[model samples]
Target: MRTGNTTMRAPGALALAAVGVLVLAGCGAGGNNMTLATGSTGGTYYPLGGEIAQLWSDNIDDVNVSTQATGASVENLRLLDNGENELILAINGVAANAANGESDFADEPLANPDDVTLLGNVYPEVLQIVATEDSGIESVADLKGKRVDMGPPGSGTEVAARQLLESQGWDPESDVEAFNSTFEEATTKLSDGQVDAAVAILAVPAASIEQVATGGTDITMVEIAGEEADQLMEDNPSYSTMEIPEGTYQGQDQPVQTLTNWASLYSTSDLDEEVAHDLVQEMYEGADDIGHDVGDQLDAETATESRGPTDLHPGAERYYEEAGVLD
Candidate 1:
């Protein structure tokens, strides 16, 4: 865990400069400039966002798209509300929290939460709980009094982790020893015995988690299922049941039913409808390129799937209308 250095990293200047040029060249007289905010370089969002921006830059003649690496979910939603980024990849829970002024958003609520709307769903972010074999943490209840990394500050993983703890009647203030760090750092702590367990909300088969699994540390993937999982879904509109299939990780012999939510693309209400339409259309048209470059989660059907709790952006609505999907 990085001490006294928890602030989110700023966007790179060189990337911003290149996007400025692209905006100047590609935009029409009105100037359609946009930025897509993703997560840290280590996670799925950064690379996936880069591919999306590339698709938009190449196909949309009237808009210029650039990508920035951010702190994921909560930070991305805040950036979109503040006009720092036009589009963002956010977890459903974080988005819901921001809109409701709950959880991370409780301290500093968005000025106008409704101004943000969903463009499309990219993939499912699974709630993953990894613990060491010696820690004896086989389930959520075993986490009491144990040292746990709740994920990076302001991350959606933290939000999900907290929800799980609260559902189990454990107060984060007194029931557990909590640490805040990036999933990569937390994985190291778990391996070295500095932490007993680590909770992360990420796409399945995470490379960072996989790294620890192969690093000779005996690990266990804790199940977040059964009655508690059902209660969690009932309590949070953003959550849904998901499964981590057998063998997705090393020595995981059974499918773990867990909670999951979509990782979705969102846009501000201010975006020109036509520009938004073009962006969504081009993304779907170039779906195969994205699958080849990133993951297959952005396939046409999944891309256009209903983003629960995420209101469809009118611009995206326009595209879906033309594509004969949004009846």
Candidate 2:
């Protein structure tokens, strides 16, 4: 939705360039075939989603696969709940919230609990705080009475950022100045000293966060460790202990503590079992340099992290069982 005079490679170009793809077994048209809903074009989900869609198309027969650019995690789940069950890339946190119908989306589960499943932990996303040293903001506790960008309205980052704030006992509405600004706007406001801090939720090795760090703002990250954090994790199983290994950001001397969730691929319950199985099997086997626009954060070890969520689809169950990955 953003038109730019400047082009910064549009995040996931190579995969999108290869977009006009269909499922492997010539799975006919898009009416009932599998579909995937990714995030905004400027974000990592889009291109990574394209590659996953391509993988499904190439592996499964007679099951068409396609990708649609959407408002990221929450919208993806909403679509699935409404019967758009192809596939989606979402923050582990959003997936958990969507699964249980708690917190931000406390109305109800978007889809039936059994209809969704975790494809895998695609990557580890970090909860980050960026600010100038002179801003006098250092930890989560100091965030009250300051301007912060939790994230966009429909994005996964917003959902997690709000939870992190509430866990710290900060009143997002009354105690602090909170705005759901875009990444570009947030960074610009921070650089201009108009905003005291930008609270973000993103995967490790996030290129956008790295760029903000490099923008001469005396960038430093906060360690979000405590019993409160543990409570947050306990309340939402999507998040687990996250660490920013030294040199992860531009100016960190040692590890910084954060919470992260698996960035997973998901599908609706309607997906045919054999087709879903083949799709998962293909993604597991076809890791390559797909060039995600937000940045390439994939690797051999990460792509195969063990222990995904409990809501396993029948098709993916077959893949895991057959690969000897599940017992």
Candidate 3:
């Protein structure tokens, strides 16, 4: 309910926003300009990505850092393929889709594109679905003949929602009406009873879900059930089990089951290995300067586990291997 809020960029803010841009490479080789393609400015990816961009700008004298607003997974990957962005923060499962050119999302059969390289993992994203209690939809299959918003077009949430629905034999176009709107708009529709459900895949304590819960309309989170969940875990190694506790989303006191998404840093092969190495090193070393809450995200322990199935970029591989994260 709180997303899509007006994120005011201060006057001349974009220019001065460079407190974290262009990490000055005082002792080394030439500096390289780097851009991080992050998700909707309204969501977690924006600030988190901004933190990284600033980290590079503030610490590494070898790179000029910038963060571009993007549509989370699908669009970020597209930007990478089109050479629009030098770096991207992708959902692990969605990254697999882009790597393989897998579904209707890409529809046009791609020739196994693989120009992107993985830097490492960032954090975990949960599949958080909010539905009105009045909708009478109790399960994933219950979504049939109902109205659902699958997040925005080209968003990681949209792709994940559709695929999970499809694997369950539900049709996005026919089984349920699908709307491609931001969580803010979708929540309004849901509150108005114009929509039956809305899906958002983000970290917990999500402002959007809190909006739905606190809005006076009763809500429920569905559990991704049975063998399909298992199949998804197997088919997509990046997905892992996550249980949402009751009361976490507006006092709906029952555990909701689902899979979680890992957010990973992906880059185009255009990046030089040494530059990539330095980028990884700087991210880890300068974590503290990015803001404590964000700094915690790049921590040495949990961060490494966030990179799903993608192979770490050779530069990152060297760092991770040396750090005892990889063999």
Candidate 4:
């Protein structure tokens, strides 16, 4: 468990003076407190965020970081824009939409999109389309007129699902029966025959998919390849092609081609450069503590190469340049 300062204030004048001193000291006179917004409980972001946050708090001096469980990507970006979170793990594609006031953020984009800077790319969030073997969903084209879980509202999965449906020239709202639910809920529904297929944007070998496979429901991974995937990637520059190797998940014998968006760390440009520098330094130095498969992907070279929608944070850039990773 994580510990935080919880001293209550006293009422007297002398007490107020003491509190004032404590506040100043706590606000960098002593340390800095920050919150990292991650994804739903069943997804990779929540657990991974906790490990990363703990790693930073343990290794960085005077820095106390906490992780917030969120709806993922879109919501995380909104939280960052509204100042509810100091740091966030978001899909680079969603971040681009938020920056440009497109898609989910069409009504109100980030107040200062330029100020949202990238720390580094954490991992690839592959678009995993899992369908029950009985659903008859052999391909993306077969999703028409079927029951599909499009992921939770305000999640990157939701955005990706809609975009994919659009890429096929179908209206997401009218063409399919869409259910907006968390990955856990969607998996449960899939296992119980409540939904035919579900969409997830997560690391390979996702626990939710694992549960369905082990729960006696034969599942098939729908491929997001060919001309459709190419057009999707061409239209959404933030996305790229990726492959989930054979046997990454239960019952998955062959490699599956799919679209991928990077899961990158983001923070406002106002973060202190020195603090950001130290944070990036410790992220790589203490990477082992992350305790997740994704941690293995963290390195100065890949970190510097996977840029986000906005410019890289100067502090992060400095660390990468000095480490001889940035070109």
Candidate 5:
């Protein structure tokens, strides 16, 4: 449906109707403009970033890519570190804490977090946490006092819901009242009871947690495995442990576990390695029109597998070293 625009400034008559759709998409004709950013308009990076910006403007030659929604992985790494986005769709643990400035870019980092690279691995995300089957939460130690939304302010679901509520010692601003919104206003404030839990970090049946598991409000999810998700993957090695299975939502039947990360595809090393190897080879040769299910986890043999702390984008490391899937 191509919807997004769930706020993050806009409104000045939709920012002059997004500057008249970037001057009828010409965006200054021959300059080969690009944008991308994405997130919110109910998650999974704005309809897979509007089908990967219309498959990189119908296959790159004179590029025009646009997309923009915003407030996703730490505001798409400060809009690709202020060059105002040339591509994004982040959350490889908030693009490795905005390239090592660490956790929510520790008080304003990234003015050039070594120009944020990487341009592949677009899947994994997970983390779910939902709640509201009367909010008895059922894990992640029952989300303390509860209200919770925790996403949207420079989200990666608010940097993994404030590091899984400071790895269970609480204090995510007074142990949960928190709201921040989006992910379709935290699934209509957790299906109208007005929040009791939310937390996202998407992909895998998360259309705002499938409208709070079929929208009649009896939701659940929670789980982040034993030993507190292995000490939150030993204190966030950009997190790991995934599962979610059991029918993947719609009152999710069993397999829960949790925590994952990898979303990927960013940009900045001032892009152009033959336009980041034709935007990672037309995003896995037009990953089946990116209709979403995380575009069946795009392939190129796992595209340099799970890249977390960035790097790679010498035009996607010369197209993953000429498609041998790089070493």
Candidate 6:
């Protein structure tokens, strides 16, 4: 992972070894200092977020950038609301939760949920439940009484895991012997016969899942569909249907039907409108710089579809309107 700033000040390396966290420092040459909050290292958010920060630092003058490791959507929203970070990469569903002051923010309601603004949509995040062959789990219902890794603490994965369990009429706290662990750690335990299944909602062909599948371990990617999936989407309007194409993973010859929550960039009202406009404009103009592999997910054509749950920032709206992305 790239760490430290690339401009504004001299770039220096600082690796936080606790959990694959890397902080990138850049010279705040243009006089604007801001931080970008991303997720765990193994997930898609960190890399993409790092690329975004780099683009902004390298292109936008006077904008100094710092990227921070966080617990993905939920944690990033908290940091953004608390004014710790100027920008955040978060899941649409989690962003909705934060905007409504529900779940994690029930007690500590954000002072200005209306101020949460969308920068652009990144891509769909599929909810994957991988069970070891030995666990005898065929469907989500089979998770009963089995030991499961419900993602890391304070993560969007954890929220989605619990929601899926609840939708199936199971008490996640009582029906399953639950443990909290990162996808990396959970993958190791799954291969070692320690955990029966792991609930992870991430970009397709996730590194963690690839780790287990390529290691020759017999694993099954359970599908979450039919009435249950419909109900899940209905309850959380931010969610949408998405499919994993055939051959996306080993032994997975058929497409898997699942629900997806979009990944989006967020900024609060505190950011200057003109600065926000420039940021959004540059993001589209510099799209090619983000690498083909990950950049494919950030299609500028559908960026306007990102306006859900949270309102679009005024500056971003101005740019999108002028560009004809928004009417």
Winner by lDDT: 4
User: lDDT tens string, model 3, 39-124?
Assistant: 77556787888877766765554466678776788888777777656788878788777666677336853233566678877767
Give the alpha carbon lDDT tens digit for every residue of 27-78 in model 6: 2334566677888877777777778778877887666566777888887887
Query: Stretches of candidate 3 above 4 Å error?
Result: 1-30, 104-106, 109-112, 234-237, 288-295, 301-309
Q: What's the true lDDT of residue 297 in model 1? A: 66
How many steric overlaps does candidate 4 have? 1
Q: How accurate is candidate 3 locally (lDDT)?
A: 0.72
- Candidate 1 residue lDDT tens string, 1-327: 101111222235356655663232234563555678888766778888887777776665545566887788999898888767778999877887887788888989998798889887777888999999899999888999999999877778888888888887779878999998887788789889999999988888887788888898888999988887877777786788888899988888888878888888888777777777777777776677775334566654666553655578888887777777777
**lDDT string, candidate 5, 1-327, tens digits:** 111211122122234446754321224555456667787788888888888777776666666676778787888788778866677888787787777898878888887887788888877888888888887888877788888888888788887888888887778999788988888878888888898888888888877888778879888888889888887788888787888789777877888888788788888776667767877888887788787887978887777665766787777877777778776
Model 6: runs farther than 4 Å from truth? 1-30
Alpha-carbon deviation at 13 in model 3, angstroms: 13
Quote the RMSD, in angstroms, for model 2.
7.1
Q: Which ranking of candidates, highest TM-score first?
A: 4, 6, 1, 3, 2, 5
Q: What is the Cα-based TM-score of model 1? A: 0.88
Off by over 4 Å in 4: 1-28, 306-309
Candidate 2, number of clashes = 10
Q: What Cα-based lDDT does every candidate model obtain?
A: 0.78, 0.66, 0.72, 0.83, 0.77, 0.78
Could you tell me how far off, in angstroms, the CA of residue 34 lies in candidate 3 after the best superposition?
2.2
Candidate 4 per-residue C-alpha lDDT over 1-327 given as tens digits, one digit per residue, 9 for 90 to 100: 122223322132234334553221135554666778899998999999888877877766677677777899999988887766778999988988887789888887778787788888888889999999999998999999999999988999999999999988999999999999999999999999999999999987788998999999999999999998988987788888899999988899999999888888989887888778877887776787777878887776777454645889999999888888886
- TM-scores, all candidates, are 0.88, 0.80, 0.82, 0.90, 0.33, 0.89
Clashes of each: 0, 10, 9, 1, 0, 11
Candidate 2 ranges with C-alpha deviation above 4 Å: 1-34, 57-65, 108-111, 292-310
CA RMSD of all predictions: 7.0, 7.1, 6.5, 5.5, 17.3, 4.7
Please give, for residues 1-327, the per-residue lDDT of candidate 2 as tens digits. 111111121223235336743232224453225567777654567667776666555544444456787767788888767754457787767776766677656876664755776665566666777766677877777777887777667778788777877777666788888887766677778777888888667666666667777888676676678986787776666677877799887887778888876677777666666666666666666555345532245432454353334377777777677767666
